[model samples]
Each structure stands twice: as C-alpha cells, then as structure tokens.
Target: MSTQTPPPVATGAGLAPLVELRGIEVVYDAAILGVADISLTVAPGEIVALLGANGAGKSTTLKATSGLLVADRALVSRGSVLFRGEDITGVAPNLLATRGIVHVLEGRHVFGHLTVEENLRTGTFLRRLGRRETERDLDEIYGYFPRLRTKRKTPAGLTSGGEQQMLAIGRALLTRPELVLLDEPSMGLAPIIVEEIFEIIAGLNRTKGTTFLVAEQNIAVSLRHAHRGYVLDGGKVVLTATAADLRERDDLHEIYLGLASV
Candidate 1:
C-alpha cells in the first residue's frame, strides 16, 4: 500500500460537508482488520466515488458510514462518522435511514419473491406515508425507472440483473435520502445496462440534488459520473483527486493493481 498521504481534493468547498469520516478503522470479529485510518468526506449535492478493487475496503468504508457493519459482526473500532457535523458513528442502520442516509448494498438485493411494486412499497414503510402519498411517491419512482413500471407486477427475482439493480436504487430513493451510499451498482451488468444505470444516477444528481457516495471497482464508469473520488488499497486510502484528475493519471491502473505507489 502507498504510504504517501493523498492530497486534499476540494468538493463543494464552500458548503458544509454532508458526510464526514475521520480516521475510520473497522474490525470484524474483534481481531481482523477491515479498513484502517480511512478518512474522506462527501459534500452536499456531489457525487463522490470510492474506487478500489475487490477486498480493497471500499465496501467496508461504506458499511462503516451507513452503520451496517454491526449486522456483519464488524464495527468502527476507531475514528468517527459524522452527518451534518453530528457524530453518528455506530448508530443503527434503520435510524440512519430515517435521518436521510440510505445504503443500496451490492448484489442487487431485492425481495426475490415479492412483486416489483410490492418490494418498492417497503421503502415507504419507514416514512409512514399515507396511501395517497405512497401512490404519488411510487409514481415518481416509476418515472425514474420506467423499466420497473413495466415490471411492476413481476416478481423481483424474475427480472434481469440490470433491472434488479435499478429496483434496488429506486427503493433506496423512495426513502427520500440526502446521501446515498451505493455499492458496486454496475456489478454483473452488461456495458449498455451499466451506462444506462449511471446515466440515471447522474440525472438524479442533477435534477433532484441528491448526493451520492458510490463504491465501485468500475473506475471508468464511476469517474465518468462522479465529481470527485478516493482510491483505496489494502484497506487504506491511497489517493484522492477530482474525477478529471484521476482520469488523467497514467499510474491509476498500476495503483489499482498494487504495482505502483501514488
């Protein structure tokens, strides 16, 4: 892993950060280290990518932020996670969701047996929306994911991989989140589907002003849509740069492959 400190990358510099992780260290089962001293920030209305290969701690970082670590028998053993300057480290995931932080975990998890629309309705449960309000929100979600509209009555497990990914995101959005922690959204999808998914994500960021912290191994797509990024390696942040700067780095491939230092 690179020992050099990543240069500070400005994101929404004039505004307060929406999410901040300070020297975060994660451990599993008390002894195994997941990630170490990882610090990063996502400013309001910005799309930030957490880029790294599998096992590079991208997911660990996201889990730590969303407080999903406890479910996996992991914990942020050091450092703090803050939201709008409030210390929320180790808070329960459900409480985090109510506070406008929603995580769409990797693997396109959905209620396999539930109808697509049924699965989507679960997102509104946390908000306790009235019937009419629920229908209106569902309509809005369907507008963003027209494919889901077409498959509203179809079982989620029967949908294509790309569709499942879309459903997962749509469900998270129904929570009306301010910061979305998206993990490996492009995984197992075709190139065209991946592009479509990213396009929608970008559109949401543009139109709805929803901030995103995306964890991805697909550097090309992630950087194409994100404003800034932090690259991780061996459970540590190795580089931080604007998306354009990272795209121009000749050694980015080497850095990802552990063949070069930042």
Candidate 2:
C-alpha cells in the first residue's frame, strides 16, 4: 500500500534555505559559549552533516536550531536562526515541531513504559489525525522499519539499542516533518545497523522529500550520505565542503585527529 507523499516543498537553488543559521552564537548557564559564530544552511531535500567529536558543539548547534536550548537555560545570545526565510531564532520547541521541524535528540529518547506503537503515536501530538489517517501513518513507519512492526507491542525500553534507534527515527517520521534535526543516529549501533539507518534516511529524502540536518561523529558514513558537510571544532566551523570534496581532501581523517583546518 502506498500513500502519495508530497514532493519536496523546498524550491530551487535560488530559493532561500530550508534552515539557515547566520553567525549564531550559543551560551550556556550565563557565560559558557557552546557554539560561536557558526553559519550554515540546509537546502530543501538536502542531507547536511555537522561533523565533530564529543564536546565539539554539534549537539549545541542542533539544539539551538530546534529551540531545545531553552530547556537547559542556554540561549542563542547572538545572530539568528531562520526557517524557510522566517525568523524563528527563539521560537518554542513545541511550536517548531508543529511547524514541520522535528528534532530527534541524541540518545534514543523513546518513553520507557510506552509500547513501540504508543511511542510512535506520540509523534502525532501536534496533528489532529482521524483514526484511519493515524493508522496509515503507523503502517508507513512500519514499512521503513519492519523490526518495529514485529516489536510493536513490546515496551520501548525492552528493545535492542538498534531497535530503539529505529523507533526514535520512526517516531519522528510520524510527525511528517519537512525537516528533521537528527543527532547521532549512528551512536552505539553496530556498523551494519548504522549503514541500514543511513540507507533508510537516504531513501526518505528521495521518496518523501524530507530534508535532514544531522549531527554526527561517524564521519566516513555521514559524508557518504550527506550532500554537504561542515566540520566544527571548539565551537567554530572549521570547514565547509560538498561531500565529495570532503572525501577527496581527506578531512575525515583530519577531523579524527583534530587537525581539520579551513
């Protein structure tokens, strides 16, 4: 069974970016800088990777874009965050989610007590879907992750790590997000699972026209799937390049060694 998904709503090259951060600076607790002077763009239907190691401000950047920083008393004290040409610098996270921006935060955050199906249902909190519509959406998510269907009745906390990751992403899809801000989809998963997740992500971008801004440390795999990448280190963007350029420059290795130079 196939439902007609909408074509990519993001316009052509001349159109504004789906998500743009212009010289944005983030601060934590009152004075600690998380990410500074970082600017990047995720064009419509594009998969863009924010590459860096732990504490490199990747998570901080994603949180800033998705309006999640407010929860931790962090703020984008400078610059701006734009969503499809509109200023959403400090919009509330729930509002952003309702506006077709979903953030799948780092660490699989599925509700422990909820069944797999229930977890998926929570993603539709913003949408007023009839029973048929909601079931159809659930089935669609199952198509992308068959393992989820098999484990649909199981408590989310009982699933394997890879299954939990799939649940996290599948839940996000239930929201029908135009843009998904994904953090560390590959973390804690086996290599085969990582590849599987990325393949599904690529398929979603192609068939559903979902744009992704993924924060990832698995450089080799991420660049393989991303259209473009930005390497961040110490709260700053060190390099921005197309995926092929990044591969050719061997920047992936440099990033691993903390030597990525602009």
Candidate 3:
C-alpha cells in the first residue's frame, strides 16, 4: 500500500461514524490488486453508495469491509476498517456478524433448499434471542417485506429473483446489524423491483437507524436513495460527494459510462 494518506470526506457529525475505511488496499493471490487506497465513511443511520460499473472494484471494497477477503485469496495489505469506533480489519466474517456487522453478498445467495422463513431464521443464529424475541423480529421482517410473509412456506429457490433479493436483505435484518454491507442489490432485477428494494432500505434507515454501505452499478437508483455516494473506477475513488451534489454533476455521466478515468 502507498504511504500517502487518502483525502478526507465528511465524518463525525457530533458522533463517530458507524463505518470508516481509511486508505485501505486489498490484493488477491499476492499479485493482483483488488482495490487500492480506498477511504470512505458512513454516519449512523445514513445510506451510502459505492457507485461504479462492472470491474470497477465495488465488490472488492465491500468484501474488505466485511472481512470476506481472505476467503477469496485476498487480504487487506494496508490501512484500517473500523466499525463503531473499533478496528475490525481482518476479523473473521462470522465474528463480524456477531458484532452486528452483517453483509448481504451479491447475487442474493439465499439457500435454495431452505424455506423462506427458514432462510430468515439463519440470520438469527449469531444473536441469542429467545423464541419470543425471535418471533417478534421475524414479524417485523415480514412487515417490511410482505411478499416474504406470503411465501414463508415456499422454498427459497422457487421464489422470483426479486423475492430472493428481498430474502437476502431480510435475513441480514434478522441479525439486527448496526451497519449493513450490501453488494449489488439492484443487479438483474426489474426497475420496479429495484425501486421497491431501495424503498425498504430507506425505511430501514429512517425507522431502524440502520447504517448501510451499498455497492451498486445502477447509478440513477443508487443516487436516489443514498445520502452520499462515491464513484469508483479502476479500483480507485474518482469522486465523493453528497447525493444531491453527485446528482447535479454532468461529469459523472462519463464515469458511469466508462468514458473517463480518474
């Protein structure tokens, strides 16, 4: 990793950020660089987006933050990842979940054989909630994704792509995460379904005070819901701005269309 410090963005609005990654670099197979010199922050109850196209390093950044890098033959070679004021870089993925850092990976990896409700139940494995609390949490999840309630008894693999995405996010909610790392939530879904998923994310941030750092390729939809967004290209952050500022900038079109390099 380079010794040069990353440029600063907004942080600590009278409280520590829910997630902070400072000058982080990741490598795979000891040769290939995944992401380099990445720095960003997510305030409590805020929705942040890592916006980029395919091969733009969005997923690599999310994987580093959630400690899933090693499983992919990658490692955080430099910098730090902090959650709720504690350094958690290189922590095991399962241990990170128990600490309220939940990651909903790309492709909505729900268990195909498990029933819808059972998939949700797997999220509660980290927390020692009693039957009553667990049931209450399940009810709340159904309240958020009513479609899942109707399909509770059905196998997850039989659900539509939109429903599978909902199941992935709902299962993460079952962990009661303080900060959620979501990768590509809008991929391969209809525009209407993407809007619905984003609405649920906004509701969760508004009512539940859950912090989100979402990696997405859908620039239009991601900006609509994000409080702030970082535009990444070739594994480096090209722009960081409030969602409103990013929306108003014309130059971002080049970045999104892969016509510009930072």
Candidate 4:
C-alpha cells in the first residue's frame, strides 16, 4: 500500500532520479512540436535548471512529467517517463502526487482564501496517515522558509509575491516529494526576494537531497543555483552543460544578449 517507489528507492544521498525522462516529446494541437525529444534526469541531491526563451519547450517538458498534458491534447508522442526506473508514460497528474512527484505551477497556486496552514494541508492529499507526521512535515517546511513561520496564520492572498512563492514551495515540500517540478520560482519578485528564494532552493538540495527540475526564464538566476542545466531552443534541447560550463561561455552571453544567433 506504499506509493514510495514501489520497491522503494535506495534510501541514501546521491541516489538516481526519483524520476527520469528519456526522449520526451510533446506535440501541439496543430501537430507542432511543443517539446521535440528531450532527455533529462533528476537525481537525488541535484537541482537542474530547464532554461529557454518565452516560446521554448521548458514548460512543456515539466507538464509532460507532471502528466498534466496527455493523449491527443498533449501527448508524450514518444519515449518514456521513468520514475524510480519504472516507465510511467501518461500517468494521471493527481496520481503522480501520491507517487512522490509534485508540480508547483508557474503562477503561485496557493488557495488565496485559505490560511497558510490550510495551504500546507492541501499537500497531504496523498498521505492519509497520522496527524503527527503531517505536523512534522509542516514544521520541516517552515524551517526551510522561516519567513513563512511568522505568517502561518495569515491568508495566502495577503502575502506578498515572494511570500506567496514560498508558500507554493512550502506546500509542495509538505508532501515530502522526492522530485518537484518547479516552474519559475523567481518570477515577478524583487531582486532581493528572488535571491532569497534561490538560496532556499540551493539549501534544500544540499541539506535534504531534494531533486528539482526547475523551469525559469531568468538564465543567470537559475544557473547560479543549478548543478547542471539544459537549454531548450525551438522545442529541442540545443545545449546541455554543467552550470559552471554555461557561465563560462561567451557563446551563451552572445545568444542570450541578442549579440549572435544560437
């Protein structure tokens, strides 16, 4: 009755992807490629940035794994989605949450009418266990984002953009997800707030071995936190490199700066 990886993943650091994608594709309603055959992995203790421009297939890749888009409307089209070495092509999105993969969408989707505690409780949809365990995860999430500690009694709508983003993440973490698909965690925040959010993301990966596949338009911001990253160009993975290698490249600067064509 445990959804914890079926046979369960190796309970140690540096473990392989709680979830893996191989040659993943997503075709549009008009048969255009939203994401044309991209392969990536999210191993324990790693944070990978999925980066691109406005129309790049970064969001599509995240959607595919989360199983939000499936069949004719938005199909995998080809290849496999492996979670703990098991193929999970076209799995239900809700079912995925139980299986230890959580997706926090681009817009902070906290329940605006609800208190911070209520928003956090929503993550417990998968785990139908004791209240003590729920409280433990709740406290653990707060430990990561101490700003949320003070505002736990406030309604989510009253929170600022950055705090709302933290709420979105804290809610996801409350599920105790092994891998999380985070879409633009730094979007629409002040520069300082953005820095703080990314710092917490980096710390989570370091301390708890939380795996992340993050989609972000802010290339520099994502690069600084990611261990490795993929650059999606026109629905295809045109570049895959370590974050350090990416930062070292004048080619990257030229392309992103409109100084040259990639």
Candidate 5:
C-alpha cells in the first residue's frame, strides 16, 4: 500500500472522508480484471476528478463507489469501499442512492418518452415526498438548469444533447445526494456546453455542499473545476495531486498517453 496521504481540500479536513476506496480491485464476469488496485478519497463539499484515457478504469472505479457494478456484471474482488468510514462494499445501488449517493452515468441517460418534468419526478420516488415538496424540489432543479424549465413539457428525447445532459444532472439533484459519482459528464458535448455543465457542477459544490467524484477524459476542464484529482493508467492510479499542482505539470498529457512516468 502507498504510504502517501492525499492533500486535503475543502472544509471537511479531519472529518472522515465522504467516500473512500481502499486498494479496491474490480472484476467483470468473475474473471476479467476491471481495475487492479485503486484507492482515493473525496472530502465533503469537494470536487475531485478522476482523469484517464478511454478504457483506463475511470468508469469502473465510479461504479464501484456507487455500487452500480452489479449492473455491469462486475464486483469488487478485493479491498473496500467506505462511506463516511462505514464499510459498504457490494451494496445495492438503490440502497446507496437512499443513503445519499447518486450516480450520473457516462452516457446521458433519460426516459426518452417522458416529458422533462415527468422525468425529474422519478428522482423523488426514493424519498417519497408529497406533491408540494416534490414541486418545490422540481423548481429548485429548474433553477439550476433553466433550459430544463423551458423544455419541461417536452419529451427528453426531443431535447438537444446538452439539454439532456443537464436534465440528467438536474434529476439527480432532486434526490438530494451528499455524494454524486458523475461519469464522463463531458462526453459527446460541445466544448462550450462542457464548460457550462462543469460550471454548474462547481456552483453546486460551492453552494449546496455537494461532494463530487467525477470521472472524465477531459483533463483540462476537469482540473479547472476540481480541487484535487487522481490520474489512472492501465487500470491503476498513477498520480494523485491537487488540481493546481497537476495543472502545472507540463508532462501531464504525456502521462495520460503513457509516454512518461509520474
């Protein structure tokens, strides 16, 4: 195990991490290795980025944390996943969501046939809020993504790619999660839209105190919005540092491409 301690970010210093992965190893179909050994931490109210190229196990790590691996026929074969210091390895994803963790998957997933407002209602099922409370929450989400409000009556499938992405995130917010595991949030979006999405992510972290563990290939934008980051290569963590420190490393692109050592 590595003896290094992660540099602290956010006001939750000295408190137990909101999420912790201790040398976790994931396997798919009980044979194929997904991640060899990966560990990291997310302090409450911090935005931490998981940076890597395609197939670098970024999504696998997020699935492990969110307990969504079972959907992919995957499991944490070794080590542990902790939420606020409580062991929760292999817990059901729905159970995890009720425990204040939610995952926005790599692809912008939405109910194509449902109107935008109807789709957001799905998020309130776990909480079982009354009609008034549900409406208030819906308003809050629309406040975050005004575009969603404009398209509230439109089918999610009719929305643009960026609008769909925003809707996915907005719906997740109605769940009132303490920790959000966001995978490839920038994928397939235009650069301007990516920037807009990340800005909202940062704003949520700042105002709502929502802790985030974001898996992304867009290192530049991820680092710009995140407080700290972990860089993965070939299914293992190769670098962990504060965002500023990582941004200053000129060889970061090379490191991502496997052309240089950390």
Candidate 6:
C-alpha cells in the first residue's frame, strides 16, 4: 500500500451524500494496481453506474466500497470510503453489511441447496427485525420480485438466470441497506431480461430512496438506467457525465464500441 494520505471531503451541498470515496487506491498485489485516484459520491435516491471495459477495475470499485473481497491481498492503499460522513476506510465486510452497505456480487452466488425463501432469509442476518418485520420485508421483496413468491420452496439454483439475479437483489433488499453495490446484473442474461433488471434498479431508487452504485460493462443499456455514469479505464476514472450527456457524445459511444473515436 502506498503511504500517501487521502484527500479531504468535498463540500456537502445540503444533505449528506449517501457514500463518498476520496482518492482511493486499491492495489491487488504489490505490483498489480486496481482502482486509483477515484473520488466520487452518490446521493440518496440516485442510481449511478461505474462504466468500464474488462479489467478496468469496475468490480474492484464495488468490492472496496462494499467492504467485501479481500483488501488484505489488495490494499486500499490510499483514500477513504465514507458512509454518512463517517470514515469507513478498511471496515470489516460484516460490519459494513450490518451498517447497510450490502453488495450483490458479480456472480449471483445464490445458495444452491437452499430454497428461495431460505436464501432471502439469509439477507436478514444483519438486521434486527422481529419475525413480523422480517415477514414484512419478505413481502416487500416479493413485491419487487413476484416470481420469487411462486418459487419460494424451490432451490435457487433451479431458477432461471434472470430470476436468480432478481433473487440476489431481492435478498439484498431484505437487509434494508442504505447503499447497495450491484455488479453486472446483466451478465449472461438475455437483452430483454437485462432491460427488466435495469427497470427494477431504477424503480427501487425512484420509489424507495435507495442509493445504488452499479458496476456494469453494458454502457448503452446502463446509461439508460443510470442518472449519472463514470467511465473507468486502466483503474482510473477517465470520464464522468450525466447519462444524457454521455449519450450525446458520439466519441464516447465509439470508445465504448472499441471503434475509432471520431
């Protein structure tokens, strides 16, 4: 890890930003660099996307903020991850989870042997709600994913790709997280299903005031769903703009498609 200190927090406009990262550097090995010099913020009720190509450090960004994936093997060598103005630098994964920083990982690691209902129940591990409240949360999750209700007794692995992704997200919702980090919800799914997943993500942020930081490679599709986007390249933020602005940039689309940025 580098010995450099992190940058100071930017001014909060009115209310506190849901999450903030300042000058954070994640080094995978002593030599393998991950994210570098990233300073970004997510406000309450916003859906933001970390857009990037393969190996551009998108997943690493989510993992660092969510406090999952070993930072020990990698070091958050620089910067601070703040949640509600509190420095969450190097906080434990379980602690972050309990504090409502839930991560729906890159792979929808659904419990293979567990029933769909059981899988959902696992999300409530960090929560202190009573049985009644837990049931209420379950109902809310089911409302978000009505399909899960039908397959509540079935093994999660037996579900369709889209359904399993929904289940992963639904289960995370059960935690009542203040911030959610979703990695590649569209992975390996049909285009139509990807659209459906993005709709749900937008709906949750719009209706429930949930804050989201999604990492996705599907730039055009994700831009439609996100309010703002940051493009990552070589472990650094190369561009940032509102979704509309990015859509307007012909050069941006060209770079995204690996064509000449005319």
Top model by lDDT, which number? 1
Of the two candidates 2 and 5, the one with more favorable lDDT, higher being better, is 5
Model 2, global lDDT: 0.87
Q: What TM-score goes with each of the models?
A: 0.95, 0.93, 0.92, 0.87, 0.95, 0.89
Per-residue lDDT for 137-256 in model 4, tens only? 888888888888899999999999999999999999877788889998888998789878888887777678788889988887778778788887777777888877886776764554
Write out the backbone clash pairs for model 5: none
RMSD of each: 5.3, 4.5, 6.6, 7.0, 5.2, 7.8
Candidate 3 least-lDDT 10 residues: 1-10
Q: lDDT scores for all predictions?
A: 0.91, 0.87, 0.87, 0.81, 0.90, 0.82
Among all windows of 10 consecutive residues in model 1, the one with the lowest summed lDDT is: 1-10
Instruction: In candidate 2, list every pair of residues with a backbone clash.
Output: none
Please list all clashing residue pairs in model 1, or write none if there are none: none
Q: 150 in model 3: Cα distance from truth in Å?
A: 1.1
Query: Which is the winner by lDDT between candidate 1 and candidate 4?
Result: 1
Query: What is candidate 6's lDDT per residue for 1-262, written digit by digit as tens?
Result: 2222222121222466889989889887667778877888887777788987888788888888988747457768888999988999888888999888999988898997999999999998777678998898899889888999999999999999999999999988888898999999999999888887877887777677788889998876777777777877767777887777776776764555446432
How many collisions between residues are there in candidate 6?
Answer: 0
Candidate 3 lDDT over 162-235, as tens digits, reads 99999999999899898899999998999889989988897777777788899998887877878789999878
- What's the lDDT for residue 52 in model 4? 79
Poorest lDDT segment (10 consecutive residues) of candidate 4: 1-10
TM-score, candidate 5, is 0.95
User: Model 1, 1-262: lDDT tens per residue?
Assistant: 2132233233466698999999999999999999988999899989999988788899999999899999999999999999999999999999999999999999989999999999999999999999999999999999989999999999999999999999999999999999999999999999889888988888888788889999998888888788899999999999998988998887877888898867
In Å, residue 67's CA in model 3 sits off its true spot by: 0.6
- Ranked by lDDT, top first: 1, 5, 2, 3, 6, 4
Task: Give stretches of model 5 more than 4 Å off.
Answer: 1-9
